[model samples]
Target chain A: MIYFDKVTKTYLDNLKALDEVTLSIEPKEMVTIVGHSGAGKSTLIKMLLAEDEPTTGSVYFESVDIHSLKRSLLTQYRRRIGIIFQDFRLLPHKTAYENVAFAMEAAGRSDEEIESDVPYALELVDLREKIWNFPSELSGGERQRVAIARAIVNQPDVLVADEPTGNLDPMNTYDVVQILKKIHDLGTTVILTTHNKGVVDSIDKRVVTMEKGKIIKDVKHGKLTL
Target chain B: MMTSMKRILRAGFLAFWRNSVVSVASVFVMTVTLSVIGSIIFTQVTLQTTLAQISDKVDVNVYFVTTAREEDILAVKTALEGLPEVAATEYVTKDKVYQDFRTRHENDSLTLQALDELEENPLGAILNVRAKETSQYASIAQFLETSDLLKKNETPIIDKVNYQQNRAAIDKLAAIIASSEKIGLFVTAILVVMSILITFNTIRLAIFTSKDEITVMRLVGASSAFSRGPFIVQGIMAGLSSAVIALAIFYPLTYWLAPFTTDFFSGLNLFSYYVDNFPQFFLMIMGSGIALGSISSVLAVRKYLKV
Candidate 1:
């Protein structure tokens, strides 16, 4: 579960990136955040990840204030939540298996555990066949799948996918969306941000729509109503 | 903990091997820096050896009158040897001095006949005093002038102290040694600092290419240490390789330069010095390489680890 208590983020030029926004997500909920570019979707995700501090208010994971945690404690907290990016920010030099295993390794997993679990995570994302392929060798869709596998390999309590499908084709996007739903059904809270209307419509779960740094609508089983 | 360490090392080797061009560039730059350091060491040693030879050629000689008692002259030699500034004192007997003078003018028959016709030997016993440092000769000369050992029964027994005659050369040599040392140290410091900066910037550029990977690692819940460990390992590898390369370069370099240096420095061989002090040189070069590489990597990776 996560809570944003009237969080606001202002840049140097007094531009409000997040303007007194408040939201909450329950455990095991797959919430898709939909907004156009510069609508504060990524800013909200960054606040949750503690990559950016809220200017005026607190962002909390469960009961602890995420931004107030010490560096070591923050790292431990982040380990419980895996994140993927639009760029599929995999280390280009590593293969699909190594990329996924890297996340597990960061969590201090044993070699035996990585050897066993990495393949399973890749299978979950339907990327097991390309396990040994480097990012350069993989197609864009396969790379996104590897990124997805990496994000969920550690079995984090929450998965944050920031515009993960932004660089994928429609078919690949659909596959990614399906994989995200499957991850949610397997009892993990999922937080996804995107400008794609079809992604929100297909999810058919909770949707939080943003406009000009403010959350304009929150709907249960909602459509993309921008 | 073992698992993490193993993973970090594996990641480091992976990155190092995968980015061969960058790794090679880093090693090359590090080798150049280390070679400069090694050269500074060799230069300093060679300069010191040459300076020591020059210092050895200059000393104060005391000539006593033939009438001066041998016991008095011997006492003077003992006292001069007691001074900390005096490195050594060679006592030449009056008979030996007379013989040396005869031998020198053997080809000049007229001078030899005049010396042989003399009723008594005129040459005095000499006490050759060498100072530990060229700068200490003036003080030693002053000590001889003021010490009571040169006088017996309130009369001066010594004929002459050659210090005043050699004072100009001694003073100039002292100045040369002092200034050369200072300038050598200054130039070495500047060169070392410049090389370190260049090496650091080169490593920074290499890490700059991986700035995005660092962010991704941080976001994936890797601790700062986890993300930083591999780069540190990579740096250490570059350092080690460069050290070996630099040392390898020095081997043939010192060997080829040895004959010329021996000829120029009056038998001080560069190759022999390198071989004799190989262990120390290895430690210095290796230590410097490791420190430079690791510190630079740590600093360069810090900016991107914030994510």
Candidate 2:
């Protein structure tokens, strides 16, 4: 579980990326954050990942202050959370299999476990055939699938997809949404941030909407009403 | 621990190979730096040997009066030998000087006939005094000027000191050598600083090319060590490659240059100097290259690895 306790982030030029936003996600829940550009969606996710510190109040995961953890402990805490970016942040130099294995390697997985699980992770994302292909050789959808495999290879407790569909075509976007749904159904908490009304409508789950720097709506079984 | 280290090293090698062009550029710059340093070192040793040879050729000659006693001349020789600055003192009798003058001008009929017409030997006994260093000659000459070898019983026992004959030329040569040495040291120091900066910038650019990989590594929960270890290894490799390349290039080059250097400066063997000090050169070049590479890598990658 993750909680944001009245978190606020203010930039030097008086830009309030996030303002007094309080939210929480329960275990195994699928949540989508919907907002226009500069809606403070990415800032909230960054706080959860401990990549940025809240200017006031605190963000916590399972009762531990995410920002206050020491560097070594913070790395350990981040291992329990998998993150995906819009750009499919895969190492270009690595093959699809190596990209997935990179996460497991970061978690200090054994060679035997890597040999067994990396293939399985790739298969779940339907990228088993592209295991040896580089990111340059794969389509946008395939690269996103590789990113998904890389994120889940360690079986982290929470998965954060920040604009995962931002760079994909509608077809690739739909496929990625389906894969994310499959991952959520398999019992990992998935938090997706996007502006696509279609993605929110397709999910039909809990939705949090934002305008400016504050959360304006949180609806259960929410549609893309905004 | 071993597994992690192996993975880190493997990752470093893979990254280096992946960015082969940048890696090669880094190596090339580092090789140039090492070679510059190596050449400066070689030039310094060679210059020192040449200066020593020149200094050995410099000696002050003192001529005694014809009426001066042999005992007095011997006393002056003993006095010059007693000075720590004086390396040696040789007493050349008047008869020997006359014979040397005749032998040197044996092909000159006018000089031989003129010497034959002389009733007595006109040459005085000479004392040749060598100083340990060219700069020390001034002090030895001053000692001769103030000593009683020049004046006894209100008459000068010495006829003339020939130090003044070649004094201007020797002083000019000494000044030139000293100034040249100072200038050489100054240029070498500037080159070293430039070498470090160039190596640093080259490594920075190479790491900047891999910026995305670094970000991904951190986002995936890789430790600081895991993310940074590869860059360190890559830097060491670049440094080591440059050093090896520089040595390979310089070895045969030194051989080709040795004969020319010997022709210009007798007994100055650069090839032999390189071989004699190969171990030291190896350590210096390799150590500097690695240090420059790794330190620059660490500094350049720090800002990007904050995640």
Candidate 3:
């Protein structure tokens, strides 16, 4: 579960990156945040990941105040959550399996656990056969799948994706959306941010629309509209 | 603890082997630094032995009174042996001294003729006294001059005391050895600093070259500690490899170069000594190289690896 209690983020010179906003989402829910460029959608995800802090409000995940978490505990907090980026961010030198196994290793999983879970996660992402391939040797969609395999490899409770399909073609976009749906069905809360109206219309899930740092609409079974 | 250490060490070693150029550079820097240090040690050892040989050549000579009987001078020689500072005392008779003079000047016919025409044995019966150190020479001379029967029993009075003859050369040799030690220390310090800087920059460039890889590792969920381990490992590897290389190069080098060094200064058989104590020399070269390499890498990574 995720909660934002009137959270506000102000940048240098009083530029409002995210205005006072409040929202909550339950576990196993799929929520899509949509807005044009310069809206607070990306800021919302950044705050959730603890990459940035709120200026005037507190954000909590599962009754635990995330901002109050000590610096040393940040790694533990991140281990239970997965973040997917538009860039893929796959290590170019690493094979797909190594990239995924690296996530488990970061969490300090035992070697046996890593060896067991990494392949399973890659299989879930339909990248098992391509696990041995490096990022430079993989296609765009496959690289994103490697990123997904790494994200879910640890079975993180919360999955936050920031415009993951922005660079993918339509077919690949459809495949990634399906993966998101599958992950959501398996009981992980999913938060996706995008400027794509078509993705919102297609998802038919809880949609939160932001405009100029404030959430203007929150709709269940939501449709995309300006 | 062992398991954890093994894990960390293996990771460190793996990280070192992962990057080629920077690791090689680190090894090279470490090798050069250790070699300079090793050579200084070798030179110091060589100087110490040479100084010992030179000191051995410096001994006190006492000429007895011409009127003193041979039995009385023999008594003086026996008395000299009782002193702790005197290592050895040899009695050179007048005839032997004359023969030594003629043999020494054999190359010059003029000096040989001068020694041949001397009527009496011009060289007196001399008591050659060697001390443990040059500093004890004055004390030995004073002791002999103050000794009882032999002190005033000389027939024509004492001819000459040769203890102070080579005093200046002995002092100069000692001063040169002391200054050489100071210079060696200063040169070693400078070389260590220079080598550390070179190794630090080389490792930094290695990290810079792989900056993108580090960034990617972080994005995927690597803790700063985990992400930083490999670079440190690379540094340690470079250090260890360089140490091995320096040892490999220096072992035979110490042997081959030892003889050449004796050409410049006699009584120093550096090559023979190291060849005889080969194990110790190997450890010295390799140990220093590895230590320097590992330390430099740890410092460099500590600065750059802070996320």
Candidate 4:
């Protein structure tokens, strides 16, 4: 569903975030990208999100060059993908329901759809009881769940979790991982980036390992390794 | 489309309330700027009215010789009245001038005695001339100097003209008012530019404070319209609230100060003036407030909205 054709990104001060890296992912696949802090994982995700342009070559979403689309079209295109972050990134003022509704609102979903889908999506993340709680009122795990609910509310085709469990406790981390596995079972292509070896061992999914700016290994049902 | 608009507007209001401190700070700055502008406008109106009243007090009086015939003086009056610059001309006979001099000197025994000592009503008949404009007085005086009444080959039908005696004060007043108006406009321009810059910076700071929220919005697949709408709305709210606040402050101020200003400035009622032009003032203050706020917000968020 996505392709990176020899993409390379170079900074002005001679830093290469991604160098001649080429990769692709199929549909309905749960893939984990394991990397150290400066292993070009964030840069790779930025290219996919079109938040940063590749210095050379191209990144494509379903055969369409992602960065070549105009701003308005890109926004429309982004609605097809949902992103989760380590910070959860929920609007501090909004309740869980409003936060999910916000994502649907951004996607131009109907009020009827938002009112109906928000609860279902919140229930999916086991946040139905605390749907009225603001981000500040929720625990880190609950906040991340709210973020996940927001991501899936629009029923995006692709789900991306960027260090989704980085801030959670052990139990919360397990709950989050299980939720990602459940989302994958529901047939959404899930691409998660994490450096946690324990989290990777539990998943037993496809692993793409990176070091520096290049991918070193790609294995189906793989274990995390340096 | 309708739902989207409602959502955007609601989100905008929510954003405004969510960032209440910044919103209040922006409104406060806006109120100060608008209040200053309003006060400047009121002062300009009051100053113009007072200057106009003062200008009316300035005129030249042409005194004719005591020996000059009443018909000759009447002819001079008719001719002076014919001039385009002369707004009015009134003939004051020697008898009336003597009477006026006596009445004016009633408080001083020495002045009354000196007036009485003048044998046979030595005071001359006078033609009081008023110009259409204060600046026209100089030309009117020059016109009179070259007139046949002043240079009558023999006994010159006119005596000394009192224009030179009053010219200095009138010219000085007019010059001062003109220069002050120029200065007032220059200062107003500076204030306007400075206020805009202040508002711009304040809004920039407000946006900078919200950068985290903006980034989250972008990351969650929010469009520019969705992300930027709240800030724009917040800005407009700040502007509108400030305008209302400024009006509330200025209305009472104008009313309370009206009596004092009327008394001090010969019945120039600022309260009435403000009330009469209230709709215009409302539009000006509110329109500028909204413009200042929205433009500043739009510009401040430009760099951050790239996502």
Candidate 5:
């Protein structure tokens, strides 16, 4: 239930990061956005996450227009959508369980709820055994899993995996892909962007390819045919 | 709101513990600020005590001529006593002055021989006058100067009339002390402002280091209000710690240091002064701590919580 209609994003330096791009995602669908570097893939998700605004057209998450939301209410809207970064931006000071619980805490979940749901979220990401380990103590695959746990901790309607497995080795990448597929199967809208051809082809989901600032192709039940 | 407040407070405490370097540094800055303020408070207390002591010893004694009639002089003393400033007055006859002087030196034979050789008593009759306080001296002196009954009557056989010889110097010193108080308060206020700025900048750096956590808080749904609480708490803790520390450091320092200041202020009872005003000093220390802590926290949190 997310839509972007004729969206154009211009950075402060007049960089036309995205231009006249129109796209929509229905409920419970997994869409993969594929592009090379500086291809506006990140800008697309950044707009949806309410981190950046469209320069010309509107971006909508469900019924609310993101561009005009006041600063106070913006966080309320953003916490509904989970995003995992390329760096696996888990708080280094926090343990795996605490990282997931941090999400619930940010959402103002009660102590009892955080205590219950954080462990459950970690278990889902197969990080139950690494719950007490800090990010530095964990392997790259495990840290990514911790990030996934934080992303899904609040049971967000949509998950944007912007190069979620970018830092992982092949085996860990495969593991992360399986986690995304499992999350998608459980009925969360999953949006992934990557130039990793192997992971993209293996997913066999709907794929959208971008070049410059425009959406070049959209294929359902498709390969990573960029 | 209640739930959020609890979260903020808990988070603030956790953050303070986790960010030890920043916390300790902030606390140290707060200590320095409070200590500076503490010294101001100490000076105010001791100065008041010294003023009170000066006032106790100060009296305006108007001396009359040796040739003045006892009756006329007594009448002048009565008139002087009528003035509102006069606390007490006594008539000192020249014979009594001579007699007391002879009794003291009579035991010393050489001084006794010199005293016997002098046929006439050189001492004038003294009007020993005590005023309400040294501050009342000017008004009392004004009254005596205007009293022709004491001043203009050659018939009264009056000669050079004078009060205490050292009143002028004492009065001048009192004026200097009063002016210095105003200047002291002004200087202390300036120092306070500088210290607060120092404290604010220090705390700001600590908050700046946690920029990533701040961004993460926003992404995870923490309100701008919630994110600010920890830094504010950190500032308050610094202030509070500074308050306690300054008192702990200053109390003993005052004890050892009071005696050293004897060179500048002879016979100053600084040790007793601190003992008497300890309550007031404690309050000042606490107030400085809270001010530095809360204001610095506000500055830091306000800047970073713009999300």
Candidate 6:
């Protein structure tokens, strides 16, 4: 369970990135955030990741304030959530398999766990055939899938995807969306942000739309009504 | 814990190999630094040996009058030898001095005839005194000039003390040795500091290229030490490799310079010194390389790990 109660983030020049935004999602629920550029979608995710602090109010995970944790505690806290980016952010020198195993290794997992789970995670994203291919050798779809495998390899409680399909072709975007659906069905809480109308309509899950820095609409099992 | 450590080490080695160009650059800079340090050691040794040879060539001689009794001369010699600054004293008897005089004139008939016409030997007995340090020669000479044994019975038996004539040369040599040591130390310190700075900047550039990887690692929940471990290990490997390269370079370098150093430094051979003190040199170069590499990596990686 994750909660953001009345969070507000203000940048220099008094620009409000998030304005008293209150939102919550239960465990095993998938939520889609739809907004144009500069709609506070990434800022909200950043707050949840503790990458940025709110100017007012606190973000919490299961009743624990995320920003209040110390350095070591913050690392442990972050390990509970998996994050994917539009860039895929895979280490260029590592193969797809190594990239996935890197997450498990960071979480102090043993070699036996990595050896068994890494292949299984990559297989979930249908990237088993390109296991040893470096990021440069992999296609954009395959790289995003590798990023997906890396995110889920450690079995985080929450998966956060910020514009993961922003750079993908239509076919690749569809594939990434289907994979997100499969992951949500497997009972992991998913928070995804995207501007693609088709992605929002296809997901048909709880949709939250934002304008400027405020959430203007919240619909359960909604279509892209923006 | 062991698993994490193994992962860190593996990642380090993998990154080092994957980024070969950067790794090579770092190693090259470290090698240059180690070489500079090694050169300083050799230079200091050569300088010390040359200064010692020059100091050994200087001493003061006391000439005794022919009328001086042998017992009085012996007593004076014993007294001069008692001083702490006196390293050694050689007594030349009157007869030996006469023999040396005759040998010198043996090449000229006129001088030999003049020497042979004398009833007894005209040359006096002599006492040669050497001091432990060139600077202490002045004090030793002063001690002899003020001692009561030379002016006994209201008449001086000592003909001349050669210290006054050699004082200027001795003082100049002492000054040269002191100033050369100071200059050597100053230059060495500057070189060492410059080398460390250059090495640090080189390692920093290598880390800068991996700044993205560091951010990705931190975002993926890697601890500070976990992320920093690989860079530190890479630095250590670079340091170790450079140290070996520098040591290997010193072997042939010293060998090539041995003849020149021996000729210029009065039998002080650089190659022999290097071979004899290989262990000491190895420790110094290896220790400095490893320390510089690891410390630079730690500091450079810190800025990127803040995310």
Each prediction's DockQ against the real complex: 0.82, 0.68, 0.36, 0.60, 0.45, 0.72
| All candidates: TM-score | 0.98, 0.88, 0.76, 0.87, 0.80, 0.90
Candidate with maximal DockQ: 1
- lDDT of each residue in A1-226, candidate 5, tens digit only: 8889899998889888998999999999999999998899999988887777788998888867888899877888878888788888877656788778878877888999998898888888887888999788999899898989999989889999999878889999999999999999999999999989988898999999998988999999778766
Worst 10-residue lDDT window, candidate 2 chain B: B148-157
The list of candidate 4 runs beyond 4 A from truth reads B62-136, B140-161, B255-260, B268-276
Segments in model 3 whose C-alpha atoms lie over 4 Å from true places: A3-25, A33-59, A65-72, A207-226, B1-18, B21-171, B210-225, B251-259, B267-278, B303-307
lDDT string for model 3 (A27-63, tens) is 8899999999889988898788777789999889888
Q: What tens-digit string does per-residue lDDT give for candidate 5 at B1-307?
A: 7877877777677767766787888888778877777777667656665666666666656666667778888888888888888888888898987788788787899987877798877767877777766667777777776667875444434554354466677588658667767887788789878877787788778778877777777777778876667667777777778888888897688788788655455566566666787787778778767776777677766765554
TM-score of chain B of each: 0.96, 0.83, 0.71, 0.77, 0.72, 0.86
- Looking at every candidate separately, what fraction of the true A–B Cα contacts under 8 Å does it contain? 0.77, 0.68, 0.34, 0.60, 0.43, 0.68
| Candidate 1 lDDT score relative to the true structure | 0.93
Which candidate order results from sorting by TM-score in descending order?
1, 6, 2, 4, 5, 3
Model 5 error, position A182 (Å): 1.7
Considering the two chains of model 4, state its CAPRI-style docking category: medium
**Candidate 5 i-RMS:** 1.8
Q: lDDT at B113 for candidate 5?
A: 85
Give a tens-digit lDDT track for model 1, residues A40-63.
999999999999888999998988
Q: Which ten residues in a row have the lowest lDDT in candidate 4 chain B?
A: B148-157
Candidate 2 has a DockQ of 0.68
Instruction: Compute the lDDT of residue B7 as modeled in candidate 2.
Output: 86
Off by over 4 Å in 1: none
DockQ measured for candidate 3: 0.36
For candidate 1, the docking band is: high
Model 3 interface CAPRI class: acceptable
Score residue B276 of candidate 5 by CA lDDT: 83
TM-score of 5: 0.80
Error in Å for residue B64 of model 4: 5.6
Residue A78, candidate 1: Cα error in Å is: 0.8
- Compare candidates 2 and 3 on TM-score and give the better one: 2
Task: Using DockQ as the measure, name the better of candidate 3 and candidate 5.
Answer: 5
